[model samples]
Target: MKLLKVSGILLLSSSLLFGCATMDKSTSTDKVKETKNTASEALKGVTDEYRKYAIGEIEDFVKATEAFTTAVKNGELVKAKELYGPARMYYERAEPIAEVFGDLDPKIDAREGDVPEAEWTGYHRIEKGLWMENTTKGYEQFAEQLMKDVNLLRAKVETVEVTPDILITGAVDLLNEVSTSKVTGEEDRYSHTDLYDFAANVQGAEKIYHLLNPALKKKDKELSNEIQTRFDEVYRLLNQQKNGNGYKLYTELTEAQVKELSQAVDALAEPLSQIGIVTEAS
Candidate 1:
């Protein structure tokens, strides 16, 4: 029962307190007005903050992908393999926001079965070359396509709008992604980088939750507390599997460990999903 402490707990606490103080002494009518204003302001701040984070992550993803592709193109298979999982960490963190662009997301991150063989070109495509094939030959075109898609993602993030619903939905979507793919090892199948992606996805979702927490605390402190506790639990489980900043390969995880992680994610997701409903009600 070791606790895995994620960053920003103090900030969330201060935000929740600040939110409470803002509404503490108001009359019913004035409270409603203030609550609306607070929620509006919080939404705008969260949107702006998340956009900045998303853009930065995509830029990093682009750089990492470029380095990875270069290694592949230069016939440095060992370097390419070394860079593979690290490169994908950025994408996993920003995926909820990046996936907003329909065509680009698929092109950048789509798994093999997600698209036709002819159309399956992205990180996973190159992944198979490095891991399954154990060589980077014949993946030049796919590597090039991945770079284009990642750059497109960076550009598109500039124009993307972030609403409260989007933030809430993105948080939930991240968790669902873990439960559906990463936990099951469906993602990063070739390289066993699922742990890195899993951690990134959780981190991404937690970012949104932290941003919205002040407003959420005002609406339902109990629910907010529950969500936070669950997040800590999940992160604790994940932290146990970490090797430095990255995680051990998915193949290293015991069946029981995977089950524990899956259950933790499920527990977090239930309370995480309620964020949208509570926000809309406020």
Candidate 2:
């Protein structure tokens, strides 16, 4: 009888523990669901805002490209040179959205040798004509093609679905563009307009960061603050190289200036990379 009584008490304790465990699990699941809902809600607002900003930039880019290509078509060498860097800036600022349409991106911006010789066209082709060849003659057809490609890009961007993952990846890719090509003076190889592209890419990434900042703060306040600080540091370094309307041409930059700017970009990129984890958490 004693053994039976002990067994009964042990079974009752076991059942109570199991009941408590089940309740705990249900509460945990509810918390997980709640977090996911909050993240989704936050992303919806930011994504819409980012989409609007991208569309506006593309519209501005189309206008700038029109002015630029017209100068090339008319064989206005000086006018085209003056307009080149500024014209490309708009496209650089919203490049991630442009890159979404893989076909259009290459056709619009591909450097010489990036595509087959006959296939190569767009901005860089015109760039070499103006800077290396020292005239816009023979580029009128290329100019016309560039205008067509950009118009197509503007049209296609309207249909793009802006999502949180896109915002995250776009921000990272912009920085990567700077670190890899812009900093090395490889992107604008012929024109030496690397500064224009570098600044524009940073601005694009910064816009994405600002849009997601409020949500990021909710997830990880410390990290959000650190990223903001890094951005400020980068901008401070870049501002030192500023010239008139544009920047000091990349060819004019001293080796030390390049190293300083590269270091600042590296610092900013490291923390910026961590942002996706906070914003994308389930």
Candidate 3:
């Protein structure tokens, strides 16, 4: 049997740290320990192969995002088009790692505005936003304009030997999710239905973490802490009251709340935008 394990940086019961605030549950201290140990048993040695791909995928994504950013900033519409495809590809590659929990997009696909009446695949949202904006004005020309910048970053991700610590960060994310099953089904607030996806992300994180932590544990405590802190920050930001909940706030949100919601979306979007950040990063 292929045993599954949950992954990193998660606290409380939920599918991933972000998204519409999950309905809450009651997982006690003892249950938490039991879950962790079960995951410890399941995830043995799984991180090795997954780590290599995850890091490479992350670096490549970063490069593609860099290219796209440069093109956008330089107003090279042609280069932007070129960057968009590969940047998107890299994002797609890393997705297996990031979207470990619940339905990745979970956007209500009810017959409605904006969402086209077509079957959709997995949701990689930041890309969706960028693609929408880029297509509106530049079309494929935008990608073409980003050629030089794209080429430059592409070379970098190809060569960067990722530190193991980064891998561990990903793994820990999974452990947190898998650790939940030990808590009893009814007690999980996000519902048992979504738990698999939640478990997936957690498992992805856990695998990466396991591969990298041994090499990192003695040397890079700060980096480890930084990842944990970021995870906490992400959860806090996601948990704050936001408008996207049920779309009921469409008319109710004030301009400031609108801005707050916008900012929250962007902040919640950070991990999703890592490749974009790499593209945009100096």
Candidate 4:
């Protein structure tokens, strides 16, 4: 009887151990599936949000550029000058999407010397007419072409898809754009509206950073916080050069001020680069 009782106890112990192992395996599998589902949903949300933003910004660009072209065609040079910076702001914000359409981007925003002189019919061409030539004469054709290109951009944006990789690359491109052109006062050289482009580019990049912050924070809170802090510092530096609602002319910045801004941008870019890696890991 004692031997039989011992045998029953051992059998019961073995069953409990096997049941516990099975439960653990099931729980781990469920956790992994749950994690994957959560990441998928988050990625979808990011993509959807960026697509909506791109569409709205492109529409706004169309409207603003239309107004700009109208001012130029009407021979209202002063009004066109005022509208120029603001008009380009919308384009700069949605530039990444516009760039996907190669043929249209050059027609709308290409700088002088970027292509053949004959092919340089865009905002910069009009910019030269307004600021350098001091007249809107002979620019009506360019203005008309610009309007058509902007409309095309709006139409194309409606169909374009925004992916996570694009968002990441766009954000980096924005900073590089500022560093290469806007910071050097080369982007809006004729009109001296580089500040407008610089600020707009920063805003564009910041939007991407803001959208990805939640996902980034989960992967590396320290790096995420550093990026946010650096962004704030850059903005603060920019705000010091603000003239009411807009920034001061790019030419107005002192060498010291320019150097400080450049450093801030570099600092931000360093941490910003990590976002793609963190996001992929998550």
Candidate 5:
């Protein structure tokens, strides 16, 4: 019973870490071809040893995260405290990648309530305020959600189904999503508090390029244009992000621009998140 009550890892950096799982489904368009060619291509470029190195590190982090989240959820306040450091290390390991891409590190800072806007970018100042006031509880709601999410994926990952019909151009959009989602602090800065999302995003995006770039050349000009168009759209939204303002960065964002930004982020989020950092048992 205590296990059920335990909370999540409370990692703001890994905030959107599991959010991208929804990307596993297919896009409506017929132009997308499902292919593992990218992964195969990547295999040649990267040694299996390297894959294990990256993938193993992430798995270890997730396990520690699971323990911490469970303790928090159980309200075993004592147990939860003990797990914080190990849990925090998971985030720390992946920080460099996340920051390089422009993500807000929970280890570094995030916005919370009552925290002055000026002190906004510092370590979850507003988060403490929110918890104190019980306004926006940090990952209070998300703790257990990902446990089920990961359990489901664990089984699926062992024998992941791949097809040649749905080729993702690459997972860069996913990395871009985690990194740039920081434009607005509201998307769950604390969620991505650690570097897990950043690592997964980078790992996943590289496969996209590694797998699809060759097939892209065989595509007709129109198909290439469409792919280019979609890719560019994602790029523009990522680039458009304010230092950390997101939509708020706009002096006066029209409803249209807001919608575009949302759509842009969503468009690339799936591929990167779904298959970004898959691992097979050695």
Candidate 6:
């Protein structure tokens, strides 16, 4: 009898402990699921907001391209030159979204020699003619094609599926665009309008960060604040180089100024890179 009683007590204790362990495990699993769901919803909201913003930028880009191309086709060299930087600014500010349409991006914005000379057409081709060749003659065909391509981009962006990865990667890519080409003054080599594109790229990345802020803050407020601070610092540095309604031409910038801007962008890029990981972890 004693042995039986002792066996029964041991069995009951084991069952109770097992039940508690199972309950704890189940509770932890539920919490993780809840966290994941929250993160997903937050990211969905960010993407939706970004989609609306991207559509607006492309709409503006289309209008600007219209005016710019019209000037080029009419042989209004001065007007075309004036419009070039501002018009490209719209495209630069929303480049990642524009890039979604693959070949259209290269067709519309490819630099000189980016493609075969036989196949070359778009803004840079016109840019070279305006500044290097010093005439808009012979550019009428390219101007018309450029306008058509930008309009198509506007139409295609309506169907773009904006997501967290797109936003995050795009933000990073914009910074990279600045660091790799715009900062080096190679993008607008003929026109010397690299600063305009550089500023626009930063603005676009900032917009992405703005959209992602709420979600990111939820996961890591400190990081969100740090990124914002860096953005402000970069913009402040850029402002020092501004000239009137536009920025000073890239050629006018001293090497030290370029280096300062490059360093600021690098500083911002480091923290901005962490945003995706934090949001995904949520």
Q: Can you give the lDDT of residue 235 in candidate 6?
A: 93
How far out, in Å, is residue 8 in model 6? 48
Query: Per-prediction TM-score, please?
Result: 0.85, 0.89, 0.28, 0.86, 0.34, 0.89
Candidate 6 — which pairs collide? none
- How many steric clashes does model 6 contain? 0
Q: For candidate 1, what is the total of clashing residue pairs?
A: 0
Task: State the weakest 10-residue window (summed lDDT) of model 6.
Answer: 1-10
- Distance from true location, Cα of 6 in model 3, Å: 8.6
Superior by lDDT: candidate 1 or candidate 5: 1
Tens digits of per-residue lDDT for model 3, 176-259: 333333122221122122222332343344334434444334446554455445545533432443323211212333556435
Error of 6 at 57 (Å): 0.5
lDDT of 1 at 157: 86
Off by over 4 Å in 1: 1-38
Q: Which scores better on TM-score, 2 or 5? A: 2
For model 4, the stretches where C-alpha displacement exceeds 4 angstroms are 1-38
Instruction: Give per-residue lDDT, candidate 4, residue 69.
Output: 94
lDDT of each: 0.81, 0.83, 0.37, 0.81, 0.40, 0.83
Model 4 Cα lDDT, one tens digit per residue, 1-282: 001221122223322333455456567566555655565567679878988887888888888888899999999999999999988987788777878899988888888889899789999999999999999999999999998888888887887877665777788788888887789888899989888888888898888888889988987999999999999999999999989888788888899999899889888887887777666525
Write model 2 residue lDDT over 27-109, tens digit each, in one string.
75665566556557777788899899999999999999999999998989999998999888889988878888989888988
